[model samples]
Target: MQVITSESVFSGHPDKVCDQISDTILDAILEQDKKARVAVETAIKDDFVFIFGEVTTTAKVDYKEVAINKLKEIGYDEPFNVLEKISKQSPDIALGVDSTESHEQGAGDQGIMFGYACNETKELMPLPIMLANQISKEMDNARKEKYSHIFGPDGKCQVSVEYEKGKPKKVKTIVVSAQTKSWINRELYEDIIINEVLTKVLDDKAIREAEILINPTGEFVIGGPYADSGLTGRKIIVDTYGGYAKHGGGAFSGKDVSKVDRSGAYYARYVAKAVVRANLADRCEVQLGYVIGISNPVSIHINTFNTGVISDEAIQGLVSKIFDFRPSMIRKELLLDEVKYQDLAKYGHCGREDLNVAWESVDLKAKQLRKLYEETKRASQVL
Candidate 1:
């Protein structure tokens, strides 16, 4: 039996906590100064929290208050030390992004971004990642509600799915780990996780005969930053396709849309989803490369993974026709100024049906691709 695995962390997870803190600060800046340029990173170890990065904005951001509030929001109210080390954007870098010879908006930095989609799920996301994210979400919700007294905030879940001939058949195994209150018994902790969390996302058919493991280490009373250090961008895999797709190694949180690492990747997803939505391919991965101070991407790649209805080359042309890879154009298409990056920090930056994000909209572009594809097929048949 062929099997694939994916894993996700809850909001209270140390790395995710840092991600949220970074994005929350970005959100705060954008709310006041939409044109702000930000590239912030957060790190947590024990009781020390450090917020460091560059900022070019006039927004009044109380770094300490924002960090403390974010920790409290995540249910970590213990006393902690907060540090801030931020500066204005480098003049040399700003010259290119702010005023280029081409007069087009340049990328925030030089990097590569990747986006992918598949027909495995309605949202066009891989099966294992979707299931893993759902399981993690369930845990986060339960911990914030009546179960708060029974379970701590930090938690994660991993899902393994068995596939028959490349199509998922059933879940094979599920592993979950979460911090529990010291007073909670082991049996009760496991019971709460299974019943209140896992079962909520999995049906009897999925869980039946499946190997379920919970807190294998036993008595996970010590977790969060106190147990392990965390830094922003550390959960890049969990924040996107759960390692189901290739990542450009650029993170989404703690930066403005001007950063190609965030916007370029988001735009790539937008185009890839359009291709799958239009039935041009069963699965598609889009890769984009950008150079700092350049509006247009240096390279654009489309891979259909042997599942394209038309040739990959033909699909590539169609994508170019329907979408623009210029940094300024992408920002306009995805309405980057209006998005709440903090909301995207949880669950993932992609495959989000819960949030009405701009990149997730593909109906119009899908229609355009479908129309053009039918014409292209007819012409080829005649040839």
Candidate 2:
């Protein structure tokens, strides 16, 4: 059987905890000064959290309190040490991003950003990651409310989907491990995760049957940062497609929109989703390259994975017209400067439907692509 696996962790997971703290600080800074140039990273370990990165914001922020409050919000009430070593954005790097001769705002750094979309899931995301993320969110809700007594704030869910002829057929197995206050009955815990979390999250059509395992170690009383250290950008795979597509190797969290790594990735998603939503392709992936000190992308690439109704070349031409990959244009189109990123620190960043994330919107671009595809098709037939 052909099987693909993907996993997602709760917001209280060590890495995610760091992600939220970093983004929380970002949101605070943005709320005050929309033009803040912040690129904060966090590292969390047992009883301590370290915050370090470059900041060039005029806004006044209490870094330590931001870290402590974010940890507390994630249900960790312990007294942990907080360290800060943040500095201003380097002049060398700033020289590129600051407006200059020919461009409005140059890229924050030189890097490539990738975006992908598929019809395998309603969110246009790959089935394995979507299922994994949904289950993680479900379990997180249970921990917050009904099952708080049994489940701790830290947990992870993994789904192994069996594919038949390149299409997802059924779930092969599901593995879930949750942190708890004490060792509970294995059977009961397993049953709750299967019935309450997995069953509710997975659509019946997506998974006919599967093996479910919970807390394989038989206990998980120790978890969160106390169990392991977590650093920002470490969970890039989880933050994106769960290895279903190629990543440009850039992390999204803890960075401002000026960082092409964040904004460029978001813009690429906007473009890819537009293609899928326009019905130009059943799946699409967009890749963009930006160089420091350039307002426009150095290169843009698109692949329909042989699923495009129109030719991939035509789609590429159309995408260029519909979307702008320039760092300044991306910031303007997505309103990135005003976005509150803390809400996107968990579950997954790409297919978020609960928040007012602008990247998820594709109506305007979809219509434009659809119209162009039809026009091109008719013109080609006449030829």
Candidate 3:
């Protein structure tokens, strides 16, 4: 059996702690100042949290208070001393990015960002990542609601799924390393985690026969920032397709949508999902390239992995016509400014049904593109 693995972390995980804090600050700033330019980063170790980056906003945001509150909300009640080192965005960089009467807004920075979609899951995401993320969410929910006495805030999950002919056939293994109360008996702890967390999400045969490892390293009393140091943008693979696709190395949280890293990536996923939803392909990945201070993408490309009903070239042509890739247009089309980065900070960003993100709802584009694909197919069988 061929196996592919993907992992996810609980909200209290060190890196996620930083991710949430950064986005929480970003959210607060955006709420007060829609036009603000924010690119923040967070790092944590022990009882210390460091927030540093470039932020130009009139939102009157209390960055320190916001970061501390977010930490507490993630189930960390420890006293954390925070150090803030923030500065304004450089006017030199901002000069080319801002919109003018004659010049449209350009990209925030130069980089490659990828978006992916497949029919393996209802969310059009890879099964391994979707399941891994669900287990983590369930773990956090259990700690918050039922087993507060037994579980701690920090934890992680990795799921390896067996595939047959490129399709997921079953789950092969589940590895859970979670923070737990030291007093809980080993027997009861495993039972609770097995029944309450694992079975609740993966009761099917996929999980029943699989090997499940719980608290592999024994005691988990020491967890969260106390256990390890965490920095933002470190989990880029977990944030997106879970190693099923390539990443352009851009982190989404903490930055406002003005940065093409966040906005452009969202738009790329929107296009990939649209292609799959249109039945033009069973799998899709769209890559968008931008140069800082340029409003439009320097390159737009697509790969259907030989799963497209039409040729990749035809699909790329359709994408050019149906979607707008300009920095300003991407923000406007996806309603980026209106979204709360904190909500997307935890779960995987691309394929989310829980959040009402514009990128996920590509039905309008799907319908139009499906019709266009039919005409294009008739016009050129060569495609």
Candidate 4:
């Protein structure tokens, strides 16, 4: 059987903590200024949190307050303790993002972004990633619920699934590492994780046979930002499709939708989801490219992996005809400029059909794509 493995981290993980912080700031700015130019980066080391990067807008919001408040909301009860540890944004980077013209919008910075979809799951997300995220989220919930003797904020989860003939067949291995207060012994820690976290996460009987690794490295007393330096964009793979597809290398956590890296990726996913929902393809991957200062996309590519009844080229043509890939157009299409990304900062970004995110809405586009596919099939049959 073919095998595919994927991993996910909890929100309290150092890298994810940074991501949440950055996006929280972005959302705050966007709330006041719909056209806010935000490119924020956060770094967490030890007990200290350092926020850097730039944002330009008319909104009169306090960055420091926002940062501290957001941290506190994310289960950090000791703000005074952590606040003294954090720093402010740098003035140099702020100069570039505080621009006026549409074309003048430089990418908050240069990087690549990727969007992907497949028939492996109803959300078109890979099963391994979906499973990994489930486990990670469950761990967080268990901690929040005060599950006895579990762990602290820092945790990571990985799932490797055995695939048969390119499809997931059964679970292979499950690994979870969670940091606990110094008092908890390893024996009790393992018992708590297995019974409370893993059991609840993989409730399906099919997953019971999988191998389990609880803190494979042994001691996790030194976790969180203290043990490891955490920075924004470090978890890009986990944020997106868990390496099931290619990543453009652009991180999504800190930038506003104007940056194609964020908005464009969301639009690409929307297009792919629509294609699959229309039954034109069982799986789809859409790629979008843009030039800084240009409103329209520089390139758009589609891959359906022979799942489409129409040629890839034909699918591309239809996509170009139906979807708008321009930065401005994408913003309008997805209403992304209005989305509150801070909440999405935690949890997996994709597969959040519950969030009512514009990218998640395929109802309108799905109908249109199905009509296009039916017309194409009719024409081909006539020939």
Candidate 5:
């Protein structure tokens, strides 16, 4: 048996909190200015939430108000005392990203982004990551439902799955560390958390038999930003493919669609999903590269783990024929500037079929890809 490990962070976890705050600001700005160039970064330590990044837009917005309101919405209250401690973005980075020409729009900063897909889950996401995300979402719902006294805004979940011959067989272990107000005692907290939260969230029999660890280090009374320091772009793995694929090291939060790092990654996933849904491959991964000041991708690479009926190069040809990887072309195709990303900041971004994110739409492209795959397969057989 082979073991695979995957992890997820709760919305109130310091880094995730920072991510949500940054994207929330981005959404607000984009709502006002569809073409707004936003590259907001956020940091949280103790009671304070500090935001810094670049923004080039004509819309007038109250940054502080946006910060406070987002905090309140995330379940932090005035009595919690986390709201009064928020800050603004830096102007230096703003100068570079605030540009008129679409091509001249420098990356808010240099880094890489990754997109991945697999046949493990219905969503084409890796099994460990899919389970981890489901657990995190369950944690949020538990908090909303007040099911567990010991569960709070900040939490982390990790799942290790055992595989047989590259196929996932069973869950090996499940770990959850959640924060709570001091109202509950340790033993009682453990009971409610494990029995109600963990058990209820992972009701699936496959996960129920796994080793369960709840707050392994014990007391979590001090959690959230108060206990740790958080910065934007810190949760990139959590943002996209969940370390299941190679990342370009580019962060997504705060940057506008003009920046290929964010927009291009979305487009790559869009293409990858199409390939998998069309039965071109049981698993597929797509890589898209862009050079600065260029509209077209430097290169596009596809890997199908040998499950593809056609060679990867042939798949690439079909992709090149079918999809546009240019930055401007991607922005228009995916409707990047139009979608509100703030909601995506909290949940796992990729598997959201309900959100109507442009990348999630495979109806049109899937058919095209299916036809291309059939044509390529027939040609290969004849050869």
Candidate 6:
């Protein structure tokens, strides 16, 4: 059997903590100035959290308060220091993107963005990552509610699924490493993690005979930033498809909607999901590339992985007709500036159905493209 592994961590994880902090600041800025240009980076080690990045906004904010509040919400109560080095964006880089008399707003930066979808799960997400995310969410809930004093804030979940002929057939194993303030017996901890966390999230049939490993390294009493360092944009894989799909090597956190790394990726997902929802393909992956000072994408590619009813080129042609990859157009269509990104900091961003995110909307543009193709084929056959 071919085994694929995917992992996810709670919001309290070191990298996730940094992600939340950065996005918290971003959301606060966006709440006041929707057109703010923000690209914040955060790093936490021990009791000190360092914040540094570029910002050009009309919004006034207390950066320290935002960071501390995020920490407290994540269940970290220890005294901490916060340092700030935020400043306005560079005019050289902004010149091309700023509105001008000759050109529309150009891309914020040059980079590629990727989007993916598959029939493996209801959310069109890969199964292993979905299972990993579900387990992580459940673990976070336990820490927040009934077991606040018992379970620690930082934790990780990894799931291995066996695939047969490109389909997930069974769960091979599950690994959970949760932090706590006290030591609990192995048997008891494993039981709680299994019954309370894993079993509740994983598919019953897939995990029927799966092996579970909990805190395999004996104890995890020390975790969070106290145990390790965390930096923003460090969990890109977990933020997207958990390694199941190709990435354009861009991170989503700590940036405003103007950055194509964040907004373009969202638009790609919007287009790919429309393709899958239209039944043109059982799976789809869309890639987009852009250059600063340009309004349109420099490159566009689509791969259905041989699962499309038509050729990849055909799908690409249809996608180009249905979706606009220009930077300004993406921001406008996806309503990126209006979104609050803090909630997207924890869970994987692509397949989120819990939030009314615009990118998750299932549009029928691809379906219309398919209908047009069918009609053309019928007309040609009549000739």
lDDT: the better of candidates 2 and 4: 2
Query: If ranked by TM-score, best first, what sequence of candidates would result?
Result: 3, 1, 6, 2, 4, 5
Query: What lDDT, from 0 to 1, does candidate 5 have?
Result: 0.76
Candidate 5 residues lying further than 4 Å off, grouped into runs, are: 78-112, 147-149, 186-188, 191-195, 199-201, 379-383
The global C-alpha lDDT for each of the candidates, from Candidate 1 onward, is: 0.90, 0.88, 0.90, 0.77, 0.76, 0.88
TM-score of decoy 1: 0.97
Worst 10 residues of 3 by lDDT: 374-383
Q: Which scores better on TM-score, 3 or 5?
A: 3
As a TM-score, model 3 comes out at: 0.98
- Order the candidates by lDDT, highest first — what do you get? 3, 1, 6, 2, 4, 5
Compute the lDDT for candidate 4.
0.77
What is the per-residue lDDT of model 3 for residues 280-312, given as tens digits with 9 covering 90 to 100? 999999999999998888899999999998789
lDDT of 5 by residue, 151-183 (tens): 668888898989998789888898888787788
Cα error, candidate 3, residue 6 (Å): 0.1
In terms of lDDT, model 6 sits at: 0.88
Cα deviation of 44 in candidate 4 (Å)? 1.3
Worst 10 residues of 6 by lDDT: 183-192
Residue pair clashes in candidate 5: 111-250, 112-248, 112-249, 112-250, 113-248
Task: Please provide, for model 2 over 109-226, each residue's C-alpha lDDT reduced to its tens digit, 9 standing for 90 to 100.
Answer: 9999999998898788999998889889999888888887888889888889888977888888888889987757767777778777776887665444787777888788999998
Candidate RMSDs in Å, in order, are 1.3, 1.5, 1.4, 3.4, 3.5, 1.4
